[model samples]
Target: MTAAVDTRPDTAPRGIRRKARAYVALTKPRVMELLLVTTAPTMFLAQGGVPNLWLVAATLIGGALSAGSASAFNCYIDRDIDRIMKRTQGRPLVTGEVTDREALIFSYVVGVASIAWLALTVNLLSAALSLGAILFYVVVYTLWLKRRTPQNIVWGGIAGCMPVLIGWAAVTNDLSWAPVILFMVIFLWTPPHYWPLSMKYRDDYAAADVPMLSVVRGRSIVGLQVILYAWATVACSLLLVPVAGMGVVYTVVAAASGLWFIWEAHRLYSRAIQHVAEVRPMRVFHSSITYLTLLFVAVGIDPLLPF
Candidate 1:
């Protein structure tokens, strides 16, 4: 649990800036960016138009806090493994930029603040969903599943899918099939989205003694699973057309981007089966992000279309 200490004076401007950056890194902002991307678009779809700007701002803030809390907790819990895995070696906890106690306290404070902020500004349902997401990511994924099961990310990804439901609940103050379908889309998308990264970092998980599919199963099997989940994600995205009466923009983008995503998955699988040394799994990893962003951008745009 120990990390190297900074001997420099704490009041120095450079030290202050470095400390701020470390705190920010503890939140895993890049991951939060992807979560927030799905959020506002879901709110737009829920409103069937642009939602109130103030409400959008409030929800995004609370969502960021919620995500930050979950990530901080994950950083704390996985600190031991973080020090071992090359991918996580530079995390604040691993680098000793933030202490274990500081991270624990920060996680609790932000989590509680997120619930309170959402409850006051958005609605109770949204706040509750945010709380549920934090708990699921921390308790279910980080503590119970991550080290124990290869299927951890599959079920754990439910937390990442929460923003769509929370955004809908914030706007409508209720649940419906439309958000559920979007939720399923993300749920299925998570495996394909994440497995590629795990494939790229198979040795990291192996070193950490974590049972990621890429660590536990052969590359070919993991590639096949990615293709399966990619197809399912695309199929789930299409459900929005009939369920929500989505228009031209969403339908075309969903179909085109889905085919692109599926193509990437198949390409990865091809490399895996051919026993190519590189396999270059990150290609599909980046492709998944582009696919989701484009699909959700269509989600936001479709509701405002003229015809």
Candidate 2:
């Protein structure tokens, strides 16, 4: 007698993969990448050269988890507004790819795990800083500032600056002027880096009743503010050369890339002031990423160079 053969397709693996991707999307991986970019280089600078590979790896992992926790919490909190904004409508919570309850649980789990991971693998200071960052982003920025103030990103941006301090503390188990200056660099850079994206999405923000600077202010005023912040960012970046005793690589890269960033900001201002139909705010948005990447790359490289 021949045995009966069953031919049923396996759908479990596919369903699991889809759910995994939705959970990762709740973490905002792109934003996490930018935060990690600042972490390792700050570690390198803190070490005054290439740091211990294990320590660097541990710190980066902890930092990523912390950032992921903050972003997931933001997604859960902003789900209502996110649905109304075209730019955010595709987010996992907004798209129903992840439920509000699942996102909240994931955030708390990841947050507790990050603090524990840092405390065990890195140091208690790094863990505390990571916890502070999570609280600032979730409580201060998401709950208090985001809906009420156009200056939300300005103060909210403080959470983003914690990685530099955390990186330094991981290496030295303490803080100093070098990390503080780097902290300020990111603090000043956040406005110029974020405002342009807000400009492009001004209408979506307005519709959501989120008071981003670009939504409440005129384009020309926003453009001018961008230019001002861009200048300040570049200026603060220069302070690292003296504060950290950086060499030719960082000095040249910071100066040249900063000039390019300033030029992009000014071009946007010119367009905004002219009342041009298309102000192309994204140009500065992309330029800011390039500037920060180049500056941090130099940060990582300068310590290794024999100068």
Candidate 3:
């Protein structure tokens, strides 16, 4: 592992600013933003309004660190394959901005720091959840499942869903049906959110020898699965309306966004059936992000209203 280094010569970023960006790139900040999006809304719902500002700050920082640590470990672990996939070919590890030893050491230092920070600033439960999330992502998702099965993200995506539970636990230090249902909502949302992206990058995965669902399954099959998961994701989103006593605001937004999400999934399926030249799976992928943002935006907003 210590001998691992970026092999690409022409693509590596130069200068200090670019190098700094490379270090940050290891954390997969874009992915971290999406993960953190789900966290705050769950906290807002747990508190029935805005949670303590300090608690919110602490939770976000801790969550970010934990996510960054896990992502860095993934970058380190997948360094070899990252070089093969066109979409991943520009990663910091593949570009040689960061050494394998440096990435591994960074992963451990940040992982431990996040656990300690959350434990001191948030609560033991939140810290515990952070630790569990990091461990699960590295052990279950990256190492154990990612290369071995096309169903990898199906089970491994649970690590991404932990933010809901962590957010709720940070506020109340207890688990309930509400957070559990929210967790399930994300669990269901994962495939629809990811499969489309995988579909677009099927060739990349094929080159990497990583059997993502879109690589292993036919386009129509992937589309059908996306639709199924979209339906389930929508169903789970609505569960919060009754379980959490969510008001009309949340219920209406969730139902409408869910319908939109389902529509996109169906459109993707239709294109697959017709064998469209360019399926544009990214349309569905982009819509999934929009759907989650709108749904969680409602989660935060609904709690602020009296209803």
Indicate which candidate wins on TM-score.
Answer: 2
Candidates 1 and 3 compared by lDDT, better number: 1
The candidate with the higher lDDT, 2 or 3, is 2
- Please write out the lDDT profile of model 2 over residues 210-244, one tens digit for every residue: 99999889999999999999999999999988888
**Against the unseen true structure, what C-alpha lDDT does each candidate score?**
0.96, 0.95, 0.94
lDDT of 1 by residue, 1-307 (tens): 8999989776788878988898889899999999999999999999999999999999999999999999999999999999999998889988888889988998899999999999999999999999999999999999999999999999999999999999899999999999999999999999999999999999999988999999989999999999999999999999999999999999999999999999999999999999999999999999999999999999999999975
- How displaced is residue 152 in candidate 3, in Å? 0.4
Query: Which has the better TM-score: candidate 1, or candidate 3?
Result: 1
What does candidate 3's lDDT look like per residue over 1-307, in tens digits?
A: 5888878675434576787788889999999999999999999999988899999999999999999999999999999999998999889989888889988999999999999999999999999999999999999999999999999999999999999899999999999999999899989999999999999999989989998999988999999999999999999899888889999999999999999999999999999999998999999999999999999999989999988
Give per-model TM-scores.
Answer: 0.96, 0.98, 0.94
The per-prediction tally of clashing pairs is 0, 0, 0
Superposed by TM-score, candidate 3 places the C-alpha of residue 289 at a distance from the truth, in angstroms, of 0.4
After superposing candidate 1, which stretches have Cα over 4 Å from the reference? 1-11
Q: List the residue pairs that clash in candidate 2.
A: none
